[model samples]
Target: MVYTICYALIFLAEILISLFYFENKFERKASKKFLIISLPTAYTILYFARLFNITVVNMLAFFVCNFFLLRLCYKAKIKSAIFHCSILLVFNVTTEFVVMLFSAAILGTELLACLDNSVNLIFQSTISKLLYFSSMYILSKVSSNERRKESPATSLMLFLLPISSTLIIYAILYSLAEYELGQVFLTLLLIGIVVLLFSNIAVFWVYEFTLKTQSRNMELEYEKQKLKSAAEYYDLLNEQNENSKIVMHDIKRHLNAIKSIAKDKAVTEYIDDFIEDFSINKSVDYCNNPMANSIVNRYKSFCDKFGVKMNIDIRSADFSFMSEPDITALLDNLLENAVEAAQNTENGFIDFSAFVRKNKYLSIQLTNSVKNIVAVKNNRIASSKKSDAIHGTGLKSIKRVVKKYDGEINMKFNEDDMTFTSNIVFEIRR
Candidate 1:
C-alpha cells in the first residue's frame, strides 16, 4: 500500500509537468479528476513493462511501437503513419539512451533509490514525478509552445501516446530478458535504451518538418484563393470607373479642339463647356502618401470616368503613429470600401479626410454612399443589399491594425444620406 501510494505521487508529478508545459505551455493546472484517471492509466502501462523483466528487445519494440501508438492517437492511419513514425522512432530511441545515461549519472543511484524507496513510497513517487517532469521538460525534443494555431485538445494525445508506447515497448523487452542469460539481458537493455533515445530525436526532426510543410501548404492555398477572388472582383468593381476615365480622356481632346477652333469672343462657349464639365465633379486630395496616393489615384481615375464625384482630403503628419507600410494598408482598405460603397449608388460620391486633431490624434474618415449596413456577427457590419463576406475581412483587417496601436474605430450608416462612414483615431505612442 505504501509503495503504491508513493509511486502514485511520482506519477502525479510527471503528469502534472507534462500537462502544464504541454497544455498551456506556461503553467501546469492540475485537475484532480484528470490526474485521478490519467496517473493509474499511465502507471498501469509502466507496470506491465516492468513485470516482463527483460530490457533489451523490449526497448527496441518500445521505440517503434510507441511511434505508431502516437500516430494512432493523432488520427493518423497505420500505413501512412508508419513512414513518418519510422524516422521519428529511430531518432527518439537514440536520444532516450543519451538522456537515460545522463539522468542516471546526474541523479546518482542513491538519489534514484531514495525516490524509489520502499518505506516512504509517496515521497519516492513524488520525487520520481519531479525527475520525470524535469527530464521531459529539459530533454524531450518537443516544445508545446512552439506549435501555434494547433488545436490544444490534440496536444494531450500527442504527449501521452509516446509515453504509453515507451512503456509497452520496455515491458516486452523486460519480459523477454527475464528468461535470457544475465549478460544478454544487460546488453539488450543498454542497446534498447540507446535505440529509444535516437528514435525520439529522429521523430522530433520529422515532426518539425511535417509541421512546417503543412503550414507552408496552407499558406500557398490561401494565396491561390486570394488571387482568384481578386481576379473575379477586379473587373466588377472597376469596370464602370475604367469607362469614365476613357470618356474624360476623350473630353480633354474635345475641349482642346474647341479652344483652337474659336477666337477670344466665341471662346466663351468653350470656357462654359469646360466649366460645366469641371463643375460636375470635385475631387479632394489630402496628404501625399505615395502608396495611398497611388491607390486613390487608381480609383479616382475610375470614378471620374463613371461620373462619381470623389473628394479626398488626405494628410498624415504622425509618422510615429504608424509605419509607412501600415499607413498604406489602412488607406488601401478604407478607400477600397469607400469606392465600393459609392460605386454601387445612382449618384455616387466618396468623401475622405484625415488630419491631426486637437488632442494630438490622427483622425482618418471616409464616407461613401450606401443604402443599409446591418450587424451580423457581433459588431461586424454586414452589407444591407449585397451579402459579400470578403468586404467584412477588409474592414476587420483595418480594425486589427487599429487595435495593435491601441486605437479606436467607429463605423455607422446614415439612412438619410445613404452613406457609410468610418472614423479612426490613432493615439500615437510618444
Candidate 2:
C-alpha cells in the first residue's frame, strides 16, 4: 500500500515536471527520448537497490543511476540534462518522503509476522513502482513528447491517460512473469520471453508511431517553408535583373541628350546634374554583377525605408555560369530575411560583404541586429510560436542551392549581443 501510494504521488509529480519545465526547453523529440529511457531505468535501479536498503540505500542507487543515465542521454552536457532531470528528481524525493510518512503511520499501530511483512513489502514495492511509473511513461508519451501541447491537462490526453496506463500495468507485470526464468533459457522459452517483453512495453509502440508522424510533419513543413522562401528569392532576383535591363534602356536616352546638347555651358550643366543625381541614388553599383547589384540596392531601399542602415562591400559576383533564375532565387531569400530581422530592431542594421575567394566560389557574409532570441532547429532558425513548416524554409532553400554547387552555409545568433551572422559559399561552374 505504501509503495503504491508513493508511486502514484511520483507519477503526479513527474507529470507536473513535464508540463512546467521540460516541454519547450530543448528540441522536443530529443527531450522525449530522455524521458522514455530514464523512467524504466530509474525504476530498475531502485529495484536492485531493494536488495540492500529501501529508503536511503535504494534511493542512493537510484540517484547514482539517474545521474549516469542522464549524462549518457545528454552526452555529458550537464546544463541540458539539469534542465530536464531536476524536475524529475524533485518529484522522486517528494514521493519517497510521502511513502516514508505513510509507512510510519501504518506500522506505528501493528507488528506483523516476518513472512507476511516481507511479502507485503515486495507487493507494495512492485505494484507501486510498476503502476505509477508506467502511468508516468504513458503520460509522457502524449505530454512531454508532443510538439507544442504545453498544457498538462488537455482533456484529450487527460481522458486517455488512465485507461492507457491501467492497460500497460497488467501487460508489463504479465510480461515480466513469463521472463521470470533466467537468461539461459533458449528455444521456446527465449521466444516466449521476447514476446512478453514486447507486449510489456506497449507504450514504446505508441511513441514510435508518434515519432513517425512527427517526422512526416517536419518533412512536409520543410517542403512548405522551402517553396515559400523560393518565391521570395526568385522575386528579389527578378526585380534586380529587370532593374539592370531598364537602366540599360535609359543609357540610350542619356547618349542622345549628350549628343544633342553640345553647347559647352549646357553640356557641363547637364553632365554635372547627371553625376549628382547618380551619386545621390547610386542604384548602379559596378563593383559587383548587375544582378547582384540590383538585389542589394533594392534590399537597401527596404532597410532605409524601415530606418535601418546597411553597409555593403561586394565584388566579383559573376553569375554568368548560374542560370539567372537560380542566382536570383538564392541571393534574394538570403538577403531578404537578413533585411527583415534587422528592420525589426530600434537602431537596427544589416551588413553585407561578398567576394570570390578562390577558383569558383562566391563567398557572402551577412550580419544583422535582431529583436528577440532566435532558435536553431537542425541548423535552421525558427520560433516556438512559428512551426517548422513556415520558418524553416528560407534556411533550407539556401542550403539546397549551396549543396547543388558543392558549397557551405553557416549561421549563428548571439543572444547577449542580439546579433545574427551568416556565411554562405557559392560555387560557380567553369
Q: Total clashing residue pairs per candidate? A: 52, 1
List runs of model 1 lying over 4 Å from the truth. Answer: 1-261, 264-268, 271-284, 287-291, 297-323, 337-353, 365-423, 428-430
Tens digit of per-residue lDDT, candidate 2, span 295-382: 7777888887899999888866566666644565577777878787777788998888887867678788888888877776446665
RMSD, candidate 1, Å = 14.9
lDDT of each residue in 1-430, candidate 1, tens digit only:
4344434433333333433323322222345575455545654564455446466544544444444333423333466456544543344344444444543454354323433434322322222333344345443335443444655665455556346545544454335434544655644544444344334434544554576689767755654464355444444444544565567668777877777777786686756667476732333333554344455666788778778889877665354557644555566667777776677678989887777777578887778886455444334564444632127556655776798888888877676666777788887676
lDDT of 1: 0.53
Candidate with top TM-score is 2
lDDT (Cα, 0-100) at 420 in candidate 2: 83
